[model samples]
Target: MAGNGGHLTPGLVNTRTHLFQAGLRGIGEGLGLLAWLSAVGEEAARLTPERAYATAAAAAAEALRSGTTTLVEHMWPHPSSEVHDAVLRALKDSDVRAVLCRGVADRADPSRRWGFDPRLMQPLEAALAHTDELIAQARGSRVDVGVAVPNPRCLTPKGMGAVRAYAEGRATLARHGVGVSYNPLSNMRLGSGIAPVPEMLEAGLSVGLGVDRAASNDTQDILEALRIGAYLQRAVHRKADLFGFPEMFAMAAGGANRMLGIEENPDGGVRAGTRADLVLHRFDRDHACLPVRDPGATLLTCGSSRTVAAVLVGGEVLVRDGEHVRLPSREPAAGLARRGSCGG
Candidate 1:
């Protein structure tokens, strides 16, 4: 009977992506990272929570189809808690484990040089307060809240201090078990320099990965983030291979699981009893199999999300025939976009 059943595999983990920006897929259109953020941020204000939710759900479906089972979502709060709660309910409805990264903003950050007009950065207290509200709002929802500090470069010392304080506050509630995801490259691409990754890692924090907004990235691939992370450590120490490949894979795998803080322990590799999370490829047993003394090398260098065959979560086929089930409509966001770049 096990053989009679069609083969199923685990999904790829998309460490970071703004679900709302999936609409910006080709719309980025060559803008430099900073300019792109400016354009996209302005553009995103048009999205209603409903639209963002639908878009995010659709992205989840896409990930499942493209070999992503568990998605660690760094989503912005809705117009209200009810709206966010509804979104989480929808995530359960759609069948993907959602780890919502509740991010705090900092208006007083000096790195505002990255096309961040004074009008954009909301006051620190306002963001902190709202973030707290959102956390409470998300309570009891299928979605889990993981606190994310804006990269230090994205915030001034004062702003980062506030963010750190917020993280501390959340720790008291999530029982010091809350997870964290940061986007240093996004900060640096916007001329904000590296976030204090070393510091955060040292703070007894559950550090994880995320690419932030697509507008801030040249490429949205998780592999690129892996590569960037290694180079970043090297630049920090002027020593290449400082973190190394083993560390990078751990970041892509276990780091994401750590970010989710899933109840089931996560080794994140394709080992048995690890939630059946895996990505099956279309290799002819030669493409990725040949010269296979080093399978990890083949995947790290030549493996791509493109060869993904199916995405299974908890042994359920969320994706089959390369399509995610229960996708929602996105015409609203597109229609709103056509009307104006969010009247914000």
Candidate 2:
């Protein structure tokens, strides 16, 4: 059989990434969440205004190449709606499947913030409406538009609720609900407190896992993200296993499908008949290293992006032997930030 070499496989659920900032991975030592954001490179600022598409596309290529099939981007500070659509198209340019979860960021008091873009409430409101309309329009089509509420530290409690309400409303459109994705790390890094994830779930919201961007996380590990979410829930509810491995697995795999609001027969375990988003990686060699017998434990603790060998998105092989097969973009966005764009 095929050993070191691999075959097309299921991909990961990368529900929260800045896409444009995909190049931003390693630059400084992260003491904690807050300290990491303080060290982010300056290239993020330049990605806005006119160069958003290139950035987003670069992120898609990075994820697609890394065996990530279902990518949900949360691109905030976008120049305009045209830029948002352009970025979405860029994600599709690759063989990997993508969900454009458009993110919006602004402050209640525009004057207090630093060099901050004025909280264009009307535009944001219009954009939210536009996302809903687009998702509906894209029914039964490839490349759908999902909604995302960007970093909440920029807003108050009312703002967080607004995000939740909008996401919940959007989820109900499909048979199962909406495909919801987010990054609490970005929010936490920006001094945003723990998201009311338990509250969001209580309110009938469908949420999923995401790794924000390399710039924010310093390192992108979905397993660590799952632990972060589970830890937060335990701290909040005082229950250790309220959100256990099974729930975490569901969140990682089916969360996007839930956000898509697609219905199923409930017997599939990453099987066929679902919108194709799968990743195949080399784990057998690594499995014997620790001398553990259970594969699930090995995957949860020992696994990282390095294990991924190939990825299939929408039945398309984006990553073969850990390489992206097709990407329409020329190259990663150009810049000076060592993290965001492959410039410096």
The CA lDDT of each predicted structure is 0.54, 0.57
lDDT of 1 by residue, 1-344 (tens): 12222223334455566665554554545556555655665555455566556555555555554455566666542234443444455566667766666545553322344313344455667656666665676666445565454344556677767666666565432343545555656666666567566666578655555665544664445545656766786798788646565655655566645435563333345666567665555433235434544545544444444444455677765654445545523432342254333332
Model 2 misplacement above 4 A: 1-10, 23-45, 48-51, 65-67, 103-108, 111-116, 119-141, 146-205, 219-224, 227-244, 262-268, 284-292, 327-344
Per-model TM-score versus the true fold: 0.64, 0.66
Model 2: number of clashes?
14
Query: How many backbone clashes does every candidate have?
Result: 5, 14
**Residue 116 of model 2: what lDDT?**
25
> Candidate 2 residues 85-142, lDDT tens each?
6676676666455666766554533332322234333355676766776566555645
The TM-score obtained by model 2 is 0.66
**lDDT score at residue 207, model 2, on the 0-100 scale:** 73
Error of 2 at 175 (Å): 8.3
